[model samples]
Target: MRSRGCAEFSIPCPVDLRKYLSESEKCGICNLTSNYICRFSMKKNEPFEETLGKTAAQMSSQKENRNCLKGPLVLDFLFAVLPYSAAKKLFDKKFSIPVVSFTNLGVLDWRRLDFGNGKINDAYLATAVKHPPSFQVSVSTFGGRCALCSSLYATEKNRRVAERFLDGMIQELESAVSPSSHKAPAKSQNNAGGGSSAQRQPAGQQEGSDSKGERADARDKGKSKSKPKRKKTVHQK
Candidate 1:
């Protein structure tokens, strides 16, 4: 089968991207290639040292880089590249954290460097050509595919894990764009009930109409009292 980029560059659905970046999105491009980046802030109440240590441990564990780096910084770096969907998948599957080191470039390094020199060379070339500080993983293609499962799917358990990751990633995208926002309104099951729009009224206007009626009634009552028909005085002339 033909490779991913060479054969055809399928555009990723925006919903899928949303599943990847939940709250915010940041993308950096170089040489016409782009990579998304996002950052999440730390809780303010914790001491710097405590927060730092916890973050360091998490990043080292998640990214699988042993060197002690500050948590917020590590999170920022991760936030930029690994979407919540991918990050959640990696954690759920118990895969080692992947690091982004420019020297290593666009290569997916999961602690042990099992991928050979040629693969490494290809990874480096891909990164250099693309110039995004992060690596992109595609389920279907090599290099672009998962680093852990590409080989581990020999057993049923591993296959299940792989499927979960792929499925979760897709679900993430699907959930990102709300159905109401992206999809056309469907024919209602209760079409006789006058469809979706008929059942709901705008809250502000609904209240305004009631208030207006009350004001008009008050005005009518005041006018009736103030202009009580002057007793048609039988002219006593």
Candidate 2:
């Protein structure tokens, strides 16, 4: 978001309420999700640790207070007591969906995903494609390796922006996990031929981790020297 001149933003994170509701068992026919909005404000050149701490605190507080359940409960009541059309209309009028969203699908079971025909090299969660100005990013882990996928309204311009944004995200993640002594220099965002392309790091090469995983690489020849102005809000849902 900082790359897009967004300093303040709110992102809604889907919360799984099954554990809270004592419905932990998997049920293919049921939906057990709710959401809590995470609001963030970034200071100029603020350390990433501060941002991460704030996000963790906010999410923890919301979950402890059971705030995520309110939306689903209200919707359930409205549909149960009112006519279908009336309920739908009322809900639509009262709620406004955010333009940007984020979700973490958690770790996928490799054993279950196996088809017994061949080994799966990689897997990631893809979000639904949305209209213009709306975007979503989803995260998943497979075999101790993290992956990120994003969906948005596509145009030549928008696609380029999204690719750059994802590339920035990957760089941030890699820096966070890498040792300070071996940290690489920041790369320029305006580099030619840059895109959100995954590059697999050798096993035990990244921070001494044993897992071999893919990371987005946006090759660059220079460094970014300027900070962008705060101009937009990133709404995540």
Global Cα lDDT for candidate 2: 0.59
In model 2, where is the ten-residue run with the lowest total lDDT?
Answer: 227-236
Report the lDDT tens digits of candidate 2 across residue range 1-237: 443434676779877777775445656557577788888787766666677788888888777787777788899999999999999999999976777788888877767777989456455566666767877777787644556666555565775566557656665654555424132235543221222224322123322322332222222226452221111111222
Model 2 clashes, total count: 4
Query: Candidate 1's residue-wise lDDT over 1-237, tens digit each?
Result: 111112221221101222234355536332222222212244544333444364345444534432222333455566579999876675557523232321212334423344454212111112111112222223221233211112221344433443344333333333332333232134321111111111111112222223211211221344432211000000000
Q: TM-score of every model?
A: 0.19, 0.69
Tell how far residue 160 is off in model 1, in angstroms: 0.9
Q: Cα deviation of 224 in candidate 2 (Å)?
A: 36
Cα deviation of 16, candidate 1, in Å: 23
- Give the per-residue Cα lDDT of candidate 1 at 164: 44
Candidate 1: residue 127 lDDT (0-100): 19
